[model samples]
Every structure is written in structure tokens, then in C-alpha cells.
Target: MKRILPLLLTLVMAQPLGAHPHVFIDTGLTLAFGPEGRLQRVKVIWIYDAFYSLLITQDMDLDQDGDGLLNPDEKAQLTGFDMQWVEGFNGDLVITQEGQELALSGPQDVTATFVEGQIVTTHWRDVTQDTAGSGTYEVTPYDASYYTAYEVTLPVEILGADQCRSRIAMPDITADLDALRQELFALDRQAQPEDAGLPNIGAKFADKVVVTCASS
Candidate 1:
């Protein structure tokens, strides 16, 4: 558990520079299937940025040993603490099969570890149903509020699917920026940037991995 006084003071005393994603995460994903070739689960790994890593280390008392690193017990505690999500937070991962979205459950087998002054979290969750399709299915991780920015740190791994291929499609930030500029200029005097054009610009900027499997 996090210390209340420090956590509260840290949150309240510091002024935010801007929007939500004051934290950045480098993300990795692995898609796994059962022997029958149906989609079973998705594993995700998040590596925190340096500043946030420092904050988390303090909040979680990750360096209890005073050697400036997380010990075994601290690592276990960190995993459990970070795995807890606030109500309605969907882990920021999405999946769709042939344009139909599939609901994903909560994370399991979660573990958090400290590596070279950074906090790394890994977990997996099962998808709702078997995805059977030759058409494109997409997996993406993003915060709709743009509170946290995510970068793909590794190519998405595919497991247990003999004939499937996956490719990553990254969003064009330049195009999104240009579009946002146009929208701002087109706005009326009373218009707000939030309401001007694209609401969830983060989603537009999210990186997606497209997977296609041959029909058995």
C-alpha cells in the first residue's frame, strides 16, 4: 500500500503542467492462442518513464532495503498494488475481430519488478470469445483521455497460431497535428478546442496491431 501523507502531498502540492498523460509508458504486447487456434489471452507489459518510475518507487516504498532497489517482498507488493484499477478503467487495451469488439477481463498473473530504476509490469487477460476470421482483427492500447501516452517498445508477439500473421500500424502524428490545427482555425469565437473537432485525439494517435489468421 502507498503512504497516504506522501501520496496526498505529492498529488496536491505539485501543479500539473498539462493534461493527463503526465506519465508515459513503453508498451509490449503478446497474443496467445490455445491449441485449438482460438484466441485465449493477451499479455501486456508496461515500462514506466524515468520520472514516474522515481515517483512510484517512493510511493510503493520499493527500496525498503535501502540499497536503492526493490527487494522480493517489495516487488510482490508493487505487483498487487499496481494491478488494482479504479472503477471503469479498462486497462487501456482493446481488441476487435472483423470489426466486432471483444470484451476483455481483468489482468491475471500480474507481476511488477524494478529494472534499472524503472518499474515494469506484466500481466495477461483472456478475451471473451474465440476469434475466427480471415479478415482483419485489431489490437490497440490507448487512453481515450490522452492522460497517458503509450509507445510500442517491441513488436507484438504471436503464439500458438500456426498460420496467422501480425503487423503493427502506427498512427500518423503529423497528420493528426495538421488536422487539429485546421479544426482550431475553423472554430468559431465561442467554440472550444475540446468541442471543435476530434474529441479523443489520443485514440487517433494510438498504435494498432492488425492480425489476420487463415480460416481452418
Candidate 2:
């Protein structure tokens, strides 16, 4: 009975965890200008995470007293996580002031590269021991995409010596910002390598709102 039970357990664990559904969300922003400060620019960030898991079968040498899934006492160290894998990673905004809200999808006059962005990433070989890895060959630069930011400037006329920038933004990412940190910890505990996309990945995120001029 004991032997049969072990086999059944193994079979059950072999089944896949099933597919993860995709959910899309957008962070909304609003800017209100005051008579004190000037609104410079309004910014927003859209983050998406899509994850799939893969199982790796490692050779376990029990006869030789190997302690891990590796050949011997070999340990794996991870320096950081890459968040660029998320798809549809782009965003733009329509500013509304007083009672006028500019429509992005609606037919209207839109100018400049406000909704467009370019990505840049820099990387270097890093060893966990705070020392070089064997020889220089041990290190290699890993180029990866970093999340891009959406930026738009508020016209300068609104800064007429008396108006101070007053702003109100919707779907603030600060709370989710805190939640994502916790999400990563949970994924690690589950030993979920593919779950990496869920942490820095945003359910929905928005930057601050700025109220400025109507020209740009």
C-alpha cells in the first residue's frame, strides 16, 4: 500500500498547473492646476506580466550523498530579476483641464512624441561573493529591456508667476508598488521561477498628475 501510494502521488504532481489567464489594466491620470505652482509634465507607466512555467529534471545522485538537485554542493545565486518580458508595454495620455479632456482615440489634433518611447538596458557580470568569478570569461554582459516611462509636458503659459501646480492622479501605483514587493516574496516561497513576471509587473500603474498650460 505504501509503495502504491507513492506512485499515485508522483502521478498527481506530474500534471501541469494549467494556463494562467491574461488580465489587462490601465492606470488613469488627472491633473488640476492651482494658482500657486506651475505644472511641468505629467507622467504615467503601464506594466504587464505574462508568465509560463517549465519543469527541469535534474540528476540526483543519492548514492554519493549529493545534498542538492545539483551534482554536488554546487549552489545557484541570482543577483536580480528581469521585468522586460511583459508584452504590450506602451502608454500615452490625454490631458484635460478646466472642463476640456482631450481624447486620444477620438479624432482630434495630437502632436509630438508623447506616447512614444525607446528602451535602454545596461548590464555587467556580477558574482555574489563580492569577488571576481574565476577569470574574466566568467562574466558576460546580459542585455535586457527595462520598463519605459511615458512623459508629456504641460505648456509654459500656465506658469505665469502666480499659478502653482496642483495635481490629482488616479490609480496611483504606490499601493500596488508596495503589494508587488510582497508578491515577489510569495513567488519565491513557491519556488516559482516563471512567476517572476508577476512582481515588478503591474496590474495597473499611474504616475503623478500635473496641471499646467493648454498649448502643449
Candidate closest to the true structure, highest lDDT: 1
For model 1 the TM-score comes to 0.81
TM-scores of the models, in the order given:
0.81, 0.22
Report how far residue 209 has shifted in candidate 2, in Å. 2.6
Lowest lDDT block of 10, candidate 2 = 133-142
Where in model 1 is the C-alpha error above 4 Å?
1-20, 64-68, 131-134, 175-198
Residues 1-216 of candidate 2 have per-residue lDDT tens digits of 011133333433455532111111123222222333322232222222111001111111121332222222322111111222233322223343343433222111111111111111112111112121111111100111102222222222222323334344444457766675455434522343244664323223333344433332
Q: Which residues of candidate 2, in runs, are more than 4 Å off?
A: 1-91, 98-100, 104-147, 150-177, 181-204, 212-216
What C-alpha lDDT does candidate 1 achieve relative to the native structure? 0.73
Clashing pairs in 1: 20-147, 21-147
lDDT of each: 0.73, 0.26
Root-mean-square deviation per candidate: 4.9, 20.6
How well does model 2 score by local distance difference test? 0.26
